[model samples]
Target chain A: AQSVTQPDARVTVSEGASLQLRCKYSYSGTPYLFWYVQYPRQGLQLLLKYYSGDPVVQGVNGFEAEFIKSNSSFHLRKASVHWSDSAVYFCAVMSNTGYQNFYFGKGTSLTVIP
Target chain B: EAGVTQSPRYAVLQEGQAVSFWCDPISGHDTLYWYQQPRDQGPQLLVYFRDEAVIDNSQLPSDRFSAVRPKGTNSTLKIQSAKQGDTATYLCASTPGTLYFGAGTRLSVL
Candidate 1:
């Protein structure tokens, strides 16, 4: 069975501070990874996705994620976070099979303090 | 183009009551998914369809939860004898290279 693990339940950082959210996955074959963000009262929006090629994928709002094959991790990062960046972030993974049913992590709540 | 849309954004019902939620996917999307998200938790896939054919539904509570995408565009999910454990936000999503989610229907069972 495929599963995603997001270690942090909540993270607080000051404005302009760099941030990193950890995500790990357990799957048998190659995985299609994705990062999604949800703002207050809004739906989950796709931030970025990694299927192949570049290990580092860039997303909206200056967000980026690096897929590490050895560690089975796809960690989301930002050079600087703003107060508006406060949202719940989720990491999801899908199998390479055509089915491509995605499994999501518990999500990490980010709070940017001004 | 409009994104995935869901109806009845909020609902409150007593335990043992019934409720239903609806979803309309993007114009050209062939894949539609339904997920259940509890407060402060990740969204869990309940069922999905691909052009009127069920792709996966292993996670759905078969006894009381049922979903269908008959025409492959609009979909409905119904829960009979709703329970407190079924109280959660029901989200509808469509896949077009990526998944686009609805704002979700928040269900509260008293």
Candidate 2:
């Protein structure tokens, strides 16, 4: 079964500090990977997606993710975290199971302190 | 120009009650998806449609849950009998190139 795993349930960091959210996926073949963020009282928004070619992809709001096929990981990273960036981050992988299914991680909640 | 739209931002019902959520996808989008997000959990796929045809619905609880995308545009998800375990946010998304989501309909079944 194709699945995404975000090991961290919650992470706290001081504003302006570097942030990294870890993600691991279980899939047999090459799958489409994505990072999504959900703010309070808002829908999930796409951050970035990786299909082929470059392993690192830039997303909106100064977010970026690198897909490492060997580790089966697609980790999200930010050089400087903003207070507004404090939200739940999810890692998703598009399944190749005939239907286009996006398997999502349970999500990691980030709390930024000023 | 508009994003995906979903109505009934919130719904509350007792066990055995019925509720229906509506969604209007982005104009010209052919693929629509419905997801259920419980508190502190990731969104799980419930069903999806390509145009007006059902592509996948294996995750949907057919005995109580039903979905339709008539005319390949607007869509609806109905729960014939709401359950306390069903308390979650129902999310609607459409895909043109990348997938975009609506704010979602939050449901609480007591």
Candidate 3:
């Protein structure tokens, strides 16, 4: 079964500080990875996705994630985070073959303190 | 284009009561999905359809839960008897390729 794991339940960082949210996935074959952000009282928004080449994928709002195949990890990073960046981040994985159902992680809640 | 839309932004129900959720996917999109998200947890897939045909509904609890996409445009999910464990936010999403999600309906069972 394909699954995603986000270790950190909550992360706190100061404004303008760098941020990195870790994610790990489990799948036998090739997997499609994604990062999504959910704000309070709103739906989730896709931040980035990794399908094939270019291990590093950039996303909206100055976010980026690197797909490390060997380690089975796709960690999200940002050079600097703003107060507005506070939200819950989810890591999802989709199988390349059969069903194509998305599996999500428990999510990491980020808090950017000013 | 308008994104996926879900009705009844919030629902409050007593145990044993019934509740229904409605979703309208993006125009021209053929696939629709339903997910359940518990407090502070990830979204779990319940069921999905492709143009009114159920692709997979293995995770759905058929005993008291039912879903339908009659015309392959709008969809509805109904729970016959609500339980405390059923309290969660119900999310609807659509995809042509990439997934687009609705604001979701927050459900609370007392």
Candidate 4:
């Protein structure tokens, strides 16, 4: 079965520090990967997505994610953390074939302390 | 684009009550999806439609849950008898390829 796993349930980092949120997926074929962030009491917002070409895809608010096919991972990264960047981040995967069911990881809660 | 729109920002109901949530996808998008998101958890797919046809609904709890995209533009998800375990945010999304989500309806069954 296709699934997404975000191993770290919570991550804390100081402002101005670099950030990385890990994600792993299980799929037999090429998968469409995505990263989304949800602020408190707000809906989710797309961060980035990867379909083909460059493994690293840029998204809004200086966020980016790299899709590593071999490792079945698509980890999200940010050069410098901002206090406002604290939010719940989710990793999702969807098959490129058939009904194209989408799967989401439990999500990683990131807290950036200033 | 107006993005996806969902009605009733919040709903509070007693167990066994029925509630419905509505969604209007972005204009011209053919695929619509419904997901249930528990507190602190990622959204879980309940059902999805391609145009007016159901593509996948395997995860939907048919015992009391039902969804419909009557005209392939607007959709509704109804829970016949709400349960305390059903307290969660219901999210609706649409896709050209990448999914676009709505603000969602937060349902609390007491």
Candidate 5:
């Protein structure tokens, strides 16, 4: 089966601090990866996705993720985080070679302190 | 374009009660998915449809849970007998390129 692991349950960082949320995946074949963010009382929003080509993918709100094939990781990163960036972050793997299959990890709660 | 939309944003019910949630996907999207998100956890896929045809429903609780997308534009998920374990936020999403989500129907079973 395919699964995603988010090592951190919660992460706190000072405002304007750089942030990195770790994610690892277990899949046999090539995997399609995605990062999603859920704000308070809002739905999960797509931050970014990686299917092929560039290993580094840019997303909304100054977020980016690098897919390290050797490690089977797609880690989300930001140069600086704002208080408004506090949200639950999820890393997902698309199981199907097709465009449909999606499996999500237990999210990492990110708190940006002012 | 409008994002995926779900109805009855909040639902409160007693155990054994029945409830249904609805979803309307983006205008031209071909895929729709239903997910169950327990508090403080990531959303788990329950079922999905590829234009009114069920592509995957392996995780859905077949005994009491049912989902359908008859016309291929909108979808509904119903629970015949709600239980405490069913108390979770039900999220609906559609895929154009990436998944667009609805705010979700938060269910509380007492």
Candidate 6:
């Protein structure tokens, strides 16, 4: 079963501090990993995605993720947090299959303090 | 160019009632997907269609949930009998390349 696991349920950081949200996935073959963020009362927006080639991918809002095949991880990172960055972040994975069925993790809630 | 659209933004119903959610995908998207997002959880794939043909619906609750993408454009998801457990945000997404989601319809069954 292909699944994404976001070990942290909630993370709190002070504004301007570095932030990291961990994500681990369980899949047999190559994985198409993505990070999505949802603000309050808003739809989910794509942060970034990794298909192949480069392991480190940059996303919108100064966010980036490194896909480590050996660790089965694709953790999201930001150099400095902002108050507006407080939202729910989800990690998803899809296989190279034709269907493109996406599996998402429970999500991690980030709270930024000013 | 407009993004995916869904309505009604919110819906409340009693158990055993029937409700349908509508989705209008992006102008030329070939793929459309419906997802259910429970509170504090990730969005789960309910069903998906590729130009009027169901690409996959294995995760959909076949007994009560049914979806249709007539004319390969607009789509609808119907719940024959609503249940409290079905309360969640119903998300509609379309993609020609990368996926773009709608505002989502929040359903609550009491």
lDDT of 2 at A62: 95
Share of the reference A-B contacts seen in candidate 6: 0.76
Which residue pairs of candidate 1 clash? none
Could you give the DockQ of candidate 2?
0.79
- Second chain of candidate 3: TM-score? 0.98
RMSD of each: 0.8, 1.0, 0.8, 0.8, 1.0, 1.0
- Candidate with more favorable, higher DockQ: 1 or 4: 1
Per-model chain B TM-scores are: 0.98, 0.98, 0.98, 0.99, 0.98, 0.98
* Lowest lDDT 10-residue stretch of candidate 5 chain B: B92-101
- Taken over the whole model, the C-alpha lDDT of each candidate is 0.94, 0.94, 0.94, 0.94, 0.94, 0.94
DockQ of each: 0.84, 0.79, 0.81, 0.75, 0.79, 0.79
Q: What is the TM-score of chain B in candidate 1?
A: 0.98
DockQ of 5: 0.79
lDDT of 2 by residue, A14-105 (tens): 99999999999999899899999999877899999998899999999999999999999999999999999999999998875565778899
Report clash pairs, candidate 5.
none
lDDT of 3 by residue, B29-58 (tens): 898999999999999999999999999999
Clashes of each: 0, 0, 0, 0, 0, 0
Show the colliding residue pairs in model 6: none
Off by over 4 Å in 1: none
> lDDT score of model 6?
0.94
